[model samples]
Target: MKKQKATIHDIAEKLKITASTVSRALNDNPRISEATKKKVLKIAKQLNYQPNHIASALRSGKSRLIGVIVPTANRNFFSSVIRGIEEIANSLNYKIIISQSYDEFDKEVQTVEALLNARVDGIIASIGKATENFDHFEKIMNKGIPLVLFDRISNELEVSQVVIDDYLGAYQTVDHLIQNGCKRIVHFTSTQRINIYKERKRGYEDALKDHGLTVDPELIVYSNMQLEDGRKKMEEILKKKISFDGVFSASDYAIMGAMQVLKEHGYKIPEQVKLAGFGNEPFTSFTEPAITTVDQKSIPMGKITAETFFELLNSPNTDTVAKKTILKPELIIRDSSK
Candidate 1:
């Protein structure tokens, strides 16, 4: 059997008021008195009345929905950022749809297209590693849709974005290792053209130069910064007879893998080899020897990203310049680098 859906007329009939008055009360219009609003809402709930957002959007031309995209939601950093975005969006009576790219360029393009098709009010995204082309992002700007990016962002697009101080974080970590009597430090970075990795790699090189150490070509390993990639790269370095006393990776997962291989090779952490990584993942603290790393400040990043998107959406001037917000990173010294 099919059940009939309740509408404003049903509530009006129950309260003996006009349908127009019921509508104003449900919308919390100032013309409706608080007493009338309470009664209308009570009966509305009793009747299981559900507002049709799609119809409302068609009338108002505003969906009040924000779409968020990330590389992968499985990471603690990405999930924490989503939570922060949700906290602000919910308070503003806006809903968010989350999509993951899974580090695939094709999937990222498809997700953007789907979100646009759904007519989201705005979008917030962290670019995937496999994304090199900017056509999809350019399309969003071409349509004058508000787009805000965070963390793994690209400078190719003239959109607002939020990011942490990757260069400063990497410099601080490498400098700390140097202060602790490490000279032959190995740097694990990515081959991708992403700004985050580029900045971190530049920081590593500058730190080595500042401390009077030559940048050893053999010690610089490039990869996707995954755990298995770290293990394979470390083994390759060992096979080539490269001697490195310290390791600083752009990712905690990669550093973790490197740690495993070093242990299997009978190398003592912070004794024969010092280790540090970026992104303070939870497991970093629970390892055999807690890893020293940099905190990305995911919660605040998410909140600020969502706030920036709303600001752009509300700005009267459509020609407003894009804003870039950079937050400071914190370096946490743990037993692994001591």
Candidate 2:
């Protein structure tokens, strides 16, 4: 016959104490003396006792786990943010569960529900490009679980958000191009569904207006932030007989797209048409003519998001209030924009 398993009652009986005393000592409650706490922990260890995580979490209503939802973990920006979150979580004795939405709304909703089932203490997310509905996030709010949004966020949602100033970053890029004698400037962006794209577009327009230049709607082009999409859109712009001396793309990938097509067509970069991009992605520096771009402080953004999440957890009173944090993005000048 197998030996009987030792329960908290057994330990309490052995120590000649009540079960409540044993439980309080095991939990290191201040009411319990340090000697009693140490004795209980030592006996529990000797018995190889393991606390039930689910039962304890149910009692305290905290899983001490954070769930992170990103569009794609493959991208450098998202990866850096993950690193930041990991660093903070580990230091705080918490764990992280990550899921990729693949920029799909349905997948994002599913991911959130899965996290909820796991009873995560908090969630950090970057809304997917295809996410127009936020009922899924509403569930988290209704359940009183803390939520933090970074990079891509919903304008309608009331929650703590961490983001860079895309508008200022774009405005400065276009202004720099204008200063470099780029008169016929063309702006390349994505669909206005996301705030980042909309803000960047607004910045580009504002810069042009500041110089007393009227923004020609025809000069503004939209395409998905993909190399092939960039190439195709550039080809369409070329077919329209549009003459542009400068190009500002919302992403580095798009910069490469326009550059590759222009180079094949014998258009000298910085000579015929200068180019500027965003994200300051690694590849931007190695391109034929290094791409000028914006640095969104991706790593720091992640770290801050993690730190902010904990701050919210510690301050329950302020958790319900909306907190907006805007980090400044720096412009990195390179050969692409001369």
Candidate 3:
């Protein structure tokens, strides 16, 4: 009813050679003569022989494949990071599988399981915003799979991580606003309890304290940091008649929303109320008053993430110490904050 697929043994029998010699010839092994390799290839083609990569990987114990997980693949930052990862991986004769979590907790756990089942040699990921319990990630370490995290990471997991210095970025932004005579500044942050936001908030408070500005509860607004969330929070702040000369948001999208609301309220940027945002999204530069922001060095972050993953993957020691790579953030001054 069904035809049998051709194997190395089939080609070997036709050429009167051993199966091992045929296998070596098919693989282009240096031990096989060029004449023998060409004959084996010809016979393989005639017999319709197909090599099973999965079986070969199982035998060798290396898939030469890496899995990469991100919150979303549509963002320029995330896409750029992936590009950097691909450059290094392709050069090393390895390929990558990408998965998006969409910032959901359950989706992240399920994706981790799927990648593991796919038999990826290692995994590189950025934790989702909704993820708090890291049991899934712990499972990876328990199974002895190399896991590398970048950008959005957890302190609870003792895995290798690559991230920019969020605290310094926030501090520089607030200090820049203060230098530009922006007193009574309002800060927009998230209550997600992620290290990035927490670090940014800490930097914001420290800058205010160091500059003789009291941290006012009314000036601090916490939200999801989306564009719509930014507008709603900004509107609520204005409704309370809060006096603020500057606005610094942890997200560029949120700051853009705040800018729209401020414009609608007849407030001129920089002249009336200085504005700044973190994460130098491309849209930040396109705004009427280009927003001052921090560059997270996505390309470098991705390259370093991949490099760290390879380090763990190649290590012979099972109990290798976890490492953390922190990149410096660059403060991009723009018209919005000038």
Candidate 4:
């Protein structure tokens, strides 16, 4: 038969001390003598004793665990954000459990539910591209767990969120192209249901209106914003014989595909068809005629999100107003947009 694990009672018996004293010593209670703690620790090492974190969490009602959900891990933007979150969390002695939604609504729901079941102290997330119903997020707050969202967020949820100023970013991108003589600029995006895309689209239209240019519905194209969608959108424009001098994509992935099609069609970037995209992905800098894009400040946004979670943890005021932080994006000038 396997030997039974040593208990605190065994340690106390060996030391000829009370179990309460042994417990206090093991816990490093200031009331215990330093010599007694040293003795207890030595005995614990001999027995290879390990504290059960599950039991500790049950007793203290704190798991010291944070849950994080992101749309996908393939993008460097999300990875950089995670690094920022981890840096702050490690300093604060908190562990984080990360989950990827793969841009699927069902996957997001499942990940959120699993984290709730794990009894995480808090959650930080960016809503998936396909996520529409926000009841799962509300359920987290209803249970008194602090919730923070970043990048993709919903205004309906009264949770703290860190996000980029998509409207201003889009507006500035369009203004740059217009100043460079891109009269028939085309806007590439996915659905308007997501807040970021919606704001970007609104900014694009508003900028055109501000410049006394017509808002051509034909100039705006909407799709999944995937690689295939980007390629197809470019092809469709050529087939339709639409005249355009510039392109503004809501995501770097879309622009990457669009650029390939543009080059194949003998278009000279910036000189002929200026191009820009959101999210200053690493590839944007290395691509031939490096793509001009907007820096979302993803890392700082993650740090702020984590800091907000700490604030929520320490706050005594239950009615603390949610912090809605929006970071401004900087336009990165590159060969693609000049």
Candidate 5:
């Protein structure tokens, strides 16, 4: 309206250089001399030069945009992870595209395909529950762009991953319940296919074995980790008369459901039956007789995943070799558990 904005051509004209040289200098390409870079930067600042990132991505191979896929965006864990990722990414002048797979396989495939077609510089994801086949992930790796996974990952693919110490978290929670004198510990779990749930199950089983407690299959219940599943499983436990004194759940939602059922049945929490859950979700702390839970270090895990993706961008040998990073989880004691 007032005046036209300065272009690379304008900067070149002012500095008596080619537009290509101006472009390189603006981008800080090493080929451009230091003196030229300083000059271009100084003049660009004066002109208030705003580089078109999308246009530049088309011209060059880098979009400075990373795609992030998670099982659900609404979940607190994934939302916190996204925050951490954005913190690092924003500092590096990059942006992210987010997609939710809804824990479905076909949706995951479509999400990956969309991100790929968008020509993202990198992708970070947590595998969905139904994502048994990894051909969609392989396509991303084949594209030679960095694909870093976090939280939920596949054992089959060789990819960079950042995850919590699920086994340790589970083990510690169970140990605490046992130390509080709960002899019969019941585990409320998701499917065995998910690596996080699998690790949690192993930890629960191993913790019982370590403490010389009987490993009772009757005490273990698979509920797909849904709220309704938790409620039904709790009822099922009562009907079966398995005689459990403690409950450890793979998810907070499930534990909350279990708590509801327990309260309805007039069972005293911690005094009679103890409860613990994974994920230090916001609701866990606010609920009546606050829940004891394992903090997954979600924010830090997300930052680490984004950092790993950036590291691969500068690496000399670009192979899809698996790089693993695991973080310790802390157990938070609360009124729900003794």
Candidate 6:
């Protein structure tokens, strides 16, 4: 047996009012009397008549939906950010649709296009690693759709972006290592395609130069930020006959990889070799010696991103506000860097 869906006509019949009057009351039109509006709403609620969002959006020209795109939801950093976004969006009566890029440029483009086609009011994104093209994001600007980028952002785009001070975070980590009697320090990083990696690498270079240490090209290794990659890279470095006493990886996962290899090779942590990583991922502290890393305040970044999007939605002149907000990163000291 099929149940007939309730419509505005059903509510109108129940209230003994014209269908046009019911429609106007549902929309809260100024011409509709306050008493009529209240009566229509009460009946609609009693009838369990859910308003069609698509129809309302078409009529009102505003969809109270926000679109959020990230690389991977499995990461703790992105998960925390999503939570923050949901908290703010819920408070503002806005719904959020989330999409993932899997670090691919084409998938990111498709995700953005789908969100746009759905007529979302705004977009919050973290650029993908393979996103060398900015034209996909340009389409949003062309359509006058507001966008807020966090974490991994396009360096060329002049849109509202929220990000951490990666340079300072990296510099501080390296500085801490130097202060703790580490002269032969090595830096392990992934791709430099994104601004976060570039800034962190720059900080590493700057810190070495500031401490009267020449930047050794051989000590700086760039590979995929993966556990296997980290282990293989450490093996290659060991094969080079280098005796580095310290390592600063760009990500905790990568550090974990290196640490496993170091342990298998019988190297002492913070004694024979001190290690530090970034992102302060949950598992970083659970490791044997634990990990000293940089906390980018990811959850706060997500909350601010949602808040900024709402501000743009409410403001008449969106172009007047600052397009970028940079947050400072904090170093979480632990046994890994002892």
Q: Quick one: best TM-score, which candidate?
A: 1
Assess each prediction's global lDDT (C-alpha) against the native. 0.93, 0.90, 0.91, 0.90, 0.91, 0.89
TM-score of each: 0.91, 0.85, 0.89, 0.90, 0.85, 0.89
The 10-residue segment of model 1 with minimum total lDDT is: 51-60
Model 1: what TM-score? 0.91
lDDT of 3: 0.91
Q: Write the per-residue lDDT of candidate 1 for residues 253-279, one digit (tens) a residue.
A: 999999999999999998999999999
lDDT of 4 at 113: 93
Clashes per prediction? 0, 0, 0, 0, 0, 0
As for TM-score, the candidate ahead, 1 or 2, is: 1
Worst 10 residues of 5 by lDDT: 313-322
**Candidate with better TM-score, 1 vs 5:** 1
**Candidate 2: global Cα-lDDT?**
0.90
Clash pairs for candidate 1: none
lDDT per residue, candidate 4, 1-338, as tens digits? Answer: 99887888888989999988987787679999999999999998998877554555776788889999998877889998998898899999899999999989899999999998887888999998788898899899888889999988888999898999999999999999988888898999887778999999999998898998888999999988887888899999988999999999998888888999999999888788999999999999999999999999988988988999899988988778999998989999899988
Q: Which stretches of candidate 3 lie over 4 Å from their true place?
A: 1-28, 32-53
When 2 and 3 are scored with lDDT, the better candidate is 3
Residues 101-217, candidate 6, lDDT per residue (tens digit)?
Answer: 999989999999999878789899999888989998989977778888999987688888899999999999999999998998889986787988899999999999999998898
- Candidate 2 per-residue lDDT, tens place, 28-74, comes to 78999999998888888888777655555787888788999999998
lDDT of candidate 3 at residue 338, scale 0 to 100: 95
| RMSD per model, one decimal | 2.3, 4.2, 2.9, 2.8, 4.2, 2.8
> Can you write out model 5's per-residue Cα lDDT over 222-287, one digit (the tens) per residue?
877878989999998887777888999999999999999999999999899999999999999998
Q: Candidates 5 and 6: which is better by TM-score?
A: 6
Task: Judge candidate 6 against the unseen true structure and give its global Cα lDDT, from 0 to 1.
Answer: 0.89
